[model samples]
Structure formats: C-alpha cells, structure tokens
Target: MSNPNSNFPLTLKQCRVIREIMKKGTEKEASSSLNLSQSSVSRALSQAEQALQVDIFTRGWSGAEPTSAGEVVISSCNSILQAISDTERQLQSNVTTLLKLKTYVEWRHLLIIEAVVKVGSASVAAQTLGMTQPAVSKTLKEIENMVQQPLFSRARRGLIPQTAAKQLASLFLRISPVAQSLQQSLQSLPNELTGRLSVGMLSFSCQDIVPIAFASIFKQHSGIRLQAMQGPYHMLANALRQGEIDCFLGLMRKGPIHPELIELPLLPAQYALIARADHPIHNDAKTLNDLVNERWIVARHGTPIRDYFESLFHSIDNKPPIQALEMLTFASSEELVIHSDAIALLFYDDWNINKLTPRLKQIPIPLPKPECTIGITLHRERQSTIIQTFIEELKLTIIDKLKTQ
Candidate 1:
C-alpha cells in the first residue's frame, strides 16, 4: 500500500492560512482578519506555495486572484478543512480519540472509503485501486477503528453504507475530485501528453459536437484514453466539482450561475416544445398555455435545464404543468414523450428528431425566451493540457458543425 503520510504533506499552519487567504482575499486582509502581521500572512502563503509547489494566488495591487493551480489548491484545501470540521463534530474529540485519529487517519483511508461506496464492494474497490481485497478490508477496518463506528454493513448483495459511512463518504467525495484533478494536472504537464480525459455531457453536446470531438481526439492521440458520462447539467456539474468528471458540455445560463465552475459558449441553442406526432396539441398550440394540461417529463430536480423549464413558464407569465418525471436522459425523455401523452422542452436538433421522425413533432408554441448558450462547464482547476486539448477539439467541431445552428 502507498504511504498515507506522503499525500497529506501540508502543515497545520498552512491549512489555517489557505482558508484565511481564500476568505479574506489577500495577505493584508488575511493578516488583519487573523490578527497577524502582513509578513506573517505572506510567510504563510509562501510556505503553502512552497509545500504545494504551485502558485496559489496572484498578488497585485487590485487584490489576490487565484491562478489555475491556486484554484486546485484552494479547492483541495477546502475539502480537507470541511472534512476535518465534520470529523470533529461527529467524533467529539477527546484527547485520546483526537490523538489516535491525528496519528492514524490519513488521506488514503478516505480514498478507500469513497472507492468502496462508489463501487459498492470491497473486492471491486480493491481491483479498481489495484490493491488486494484484504488490504482494502484492513484499511476500512482501520477507518472504523479511528471513527469508532461501523461504516458499512456487510450485505448479501454488497456493502450497505450506513449513516456514518454515507456521511463520511460524501465528505470524501468532495475531496476525491480535487485529488483526481491534481493527478490529471500532473499527468498533463505541457511537455507530456499522457493522461485520461473524462467529459460529462448532456443532450445538446451528444447531438453533435461531443462525438465529433471524441472522434478527432482519439484519431490524434492513440496513447490517451477518452471517456464520456451523460447526464443533466446540475448532476454533471456536481460531478465536475467533485472531480467525478472533468467538465460537462451542455446549455449554460447566460450569466455566472456557479462561481466555482466557468462556462465557455460553444453554440446558440434554440428550444422547441416537442410531442408525439399524434399528440393532441401539436397542430393547435398557439402559446405555452395550450399545453398546460399535458403531462411533462423533465431533467432531475435542481438541474439547470429542468430549472430552465420552470423559468420558461415564469417568463411567459404562465403556470407550468403540475406533474413531472425526473428523467435526466434526453433520449429517455424523448422515447417516453414519443410514446406517451407528454411533451418535452428540447434543443432544436434535426439529428435528434430525424431518427424518431413521423412519430414526434414540435408544438407551435411561440417561445419568447432568448436562445440558450450551449457550452462546456469547466471547474476552476480545469485548465490542464489534456482538458484544453479536448475542449479545443470540441470548439473545432462546433465551428464545423454546430456554429451556424
């Protein structure tokens, strides 16, 4: 097993100062907030920078701005801090529990826990982690000992993550992405080309740009492995932030909805309210109001697209359909709407429509909302070479295929 100490190589003071600077925004601000001198704050920042071997902040007259590397460091540091806070709150740290945890708990334990929860089996986690089953078990036992609770309940099907395990795993999920992004960053240093790139995208991207980019990316670099995960924007955005996926390609709201992740526009996407060709309102619809009684299929709750549907109704000063099914896949929603008496709000794509044509048609509702910007959402730390390469191909594909549409 890899040594745990090597991974968590930051000092206590370094952890303290990362938050201070992130919150207060500058050495002077941190010093003033923490009741320390400016030089102390500077030293703390410098020490953290030296330990991390990356520029965590750009110091200038206007204030401190985080560079890409800084963004990664801050993200990872925030996870660590939050995890520590959770541990303290749950464990109620006495001298012994505190000392035992401080001495025994390492970054690897959380990694193993998260892997187990993700894959739902110790054996699978072992295989994924390239460790023996016994080794993964031993690590989980160690984690249980440190936390003084059973994390997983052995089940007939798989390990059933209990409350403690689930909560702890959730905290680790936040950290794992930063750790993963860091590894990807190291792998994709400007001179080297070896790395894995995973992009999570939704329907609009799948209709054209993403696949085209995928083809070009594979053709250019046989050595690199490329993967894609499809889901709604909110789910994929959570994945992107957790480092579950590098970025999510789809329709983005015009302004900044998420400060941690940035959106770069790829194409203009216009919406259409679609129903099965035999749908009652397909020919008669004059406005959104004509379809208020129809059933609806939508992206999962809290998703940008699903929320956009809500905003669409509010924009027209109309009440939306009362019912919803949280089907995140556009294809699945399309299939359901094609056969059932429901309608879907979708980006206008002939490719999406052409395959299932004669069965599905667009409602004649006059949509007054502005066209949505379809694009990719990149986390603050996603400026690495491999990610950049993939995004470049996506843009090129857009220019060739989707720019006009």
Candidate 2:
C-alpha cells in the first residue's frame, strides 16, 4: 500500500494532523485519539503546515485553535480520508474482476456507473445519460445477462446496487488511479471535447447561412456536437431564463437586457426594410418620413428587432406605423414579406447571406441607420463547460464570417 503521506507527496498527512488537532484541542488530546506521541503529532503538523506553505493553527494557553488555513485543511482532509476509506473497503472486496470489466467496456459506460453512484436514481441516471428509462433498464439488463447475476435491486424511490454492484463498486474503487493514468496518457491529444450544445438564434440569423457555417466548424472539430433552435428574440430570452438553451445569438438593441444574462458583442449587422419585389413600398418608401404612412410587419414587442425598429422610427416621427402582424417564425415572417404588400424589417447582412434578396427588395428608405448589435447571451448562472466551449466556437465562426464580409 502506498503511504498517504508519500502518495500525496505534499500535504495530506499534515492536513490530517491539523484536522485532528482542531477536533481534539491541545497536543495531549490529539495524541491520545490518533494513538501517536504528543511530540510526533506536533512535529507532523508543523512539517505539514511548512510543506503546504501555510500556517494551519494558532497555539493558545487553553488549547490549539484552527486558523483559516487550518479550517480549509480540515475540510480537505475530511474529503480525502473518506475517499481513502472508501477506496480501501472497495479494494478489500473486489479488484481483479473490476480490472477485467473496465478493460472490456468503453469509458462512457464507466461514466454512467459513476453517475448512478452519485445520483442513486436510475431515472435520473437515464436523463443524465440522455437515454430513456426503458433504455437504461435494457442496458442494465444486458450487463446482468453478460455477468449472469443481478447488479441492482429496485427500491421505492430508486434502484440499489446488489452484491454484484457492490463488487463492481469495489472494482471501481481503483477507478481514480486508472482514470488518472488514462487521462495523463491522453493529455497530449489535440481534439475538441465532445458534447452537444443547444443555442437559440434570432429567426433571420438562422436562415441557412449561420447553421451552414457551424456545420463546417463541426466538420473540422469532429468531437464537437451541435444543436440549434431559432425563434424571435423574446422567445429565445425566455428559453435562456428557463435554462432550456445554452446561448442566445442575436442583436441587442433593446434597452436593458435581463440583469441575469451575459451579452458579448460579436459583429455589427445593420437594419434594412425588406419587401416583396412586387410591393409598391419597395419603390415608394425612399426616405424615413415615407415609412410613417406605410403599413409594416414588425416582430412583436419585447423582441430586440421591435425595440430597435421602434426607436429608429421614434427618432424621426413621434408615432410609427402599427404592425400589421406579430409573427414569430422566420418562415412565417419571410412569407408575409414575400407574399404581401406589407414591408418588414430585416438585417441586411442576413438577407444578403441567405439569398433572400431574390424574394425581397431592400426599400431605399434611409431610417436611423441603426446597426444590429449582433451578440451572444446566456443566463450568467447557467454556464457549463460545454456551453462556454460552444460560445467560443460561435465567436470564432462569426469573426470568420465578418472577415469575408
């Protein structure tokens, strides 16, 4: 067995001594509990504190008191000792079978087992595995069939591991060492972390161009997985708040974004009035004032588009034309602009990128020349490792898009 003092090769025993001293108070009390000499305890603690490069305790006339560093060490020691005890117990029970099982299975199955140990609920394990409960059950059943023994037992709330699972857990007791070794061996690998990211984009932005760019990125970083959803800005905002999405990709002309969200500036997209080629306003609405009398198809209130459009019109005329429709989907809105006499607001870059210019004409109306604040946002509290990575990839993709533009 490797010595805890040496394996950590730094501070575990020192931390253990400090924690014991804090719990017992005074050298005599700690020495008796740890079955060590008072001098040994004192020396070990001093050596540990010195090795860790921190003072862990304050000696008082009455007893020893834990300093801030001592308290921190105590917390760490508790976790370390618990893990060590668990490891010891597991190894005493099973090690050979586990080594064989781990060699045969993929790492993902091991990850699922770890999740099961953490959650103690098969249903929750299923969700974390991104699988149905039936699928999780079937997988477990297959494992049992392969071993010819029961691995878990059904309980009132969740499933509990049986003797077979206990044996597996014992085998898994060696996981940290094996995992550490595996991780170290793979450390020099040059691959993006593999995971799915769900992003919400403004309707106009998702018009084939953006997703196509992301697909190219995925091809390059094959480890990266992508999932995208699109709707009006408000719908995306609501989804962000509810933690249903990872990031919001769009303009932010609206006043006061939610305090909970973090918005990062990307590219500058500009506004343009788009109408069907046959629409009368395409030729008539040449200036800002001319749009006052023209009927418009604006995205509903609370959307970033509506905010920017309203503000730009308000700068010229006190009243803007009422929206003929409050459509949400880009398809519906695009169709409205394509088949109707009504003029709709669009981001010029997006319209140009999507080949939408064929179906719609940019009315030469000079509005406030508001540039779309194309940015990305997500609820500040909801950032995960995968989400942050996706945001970085998105920014790179957007920058590349802007360079070509």
lDDT of each: 0.70, 0.62
Candidate 1 lDDT tens digits, 1-405 = 455434544543565677778788777788887777889878878877776676676542235656556665676677776666766566544324442443345567877888899889999999887789999999999988877767888889999997767766776667555554654553354443544567887754555567788889788775455667676666676767766577777777665466898988876666778788887786677777776677888776655666778887887788766787767666678799888987887775443434446778877777766366777789987578889998889778766663343
- Residue 108 accuracy (lDDT) in model 1: 74
TM-score of 2: 0.48
Model 1 stretches with alpha carbons more than 4 Å out? 1-192, 203-207, 232-235, 254-258, 315-318, 349-356, 402-405
* Model 1: per-residue Cα lDDT at residue 375: 75
What lDDT is reached at residue 36 by model 1? 77
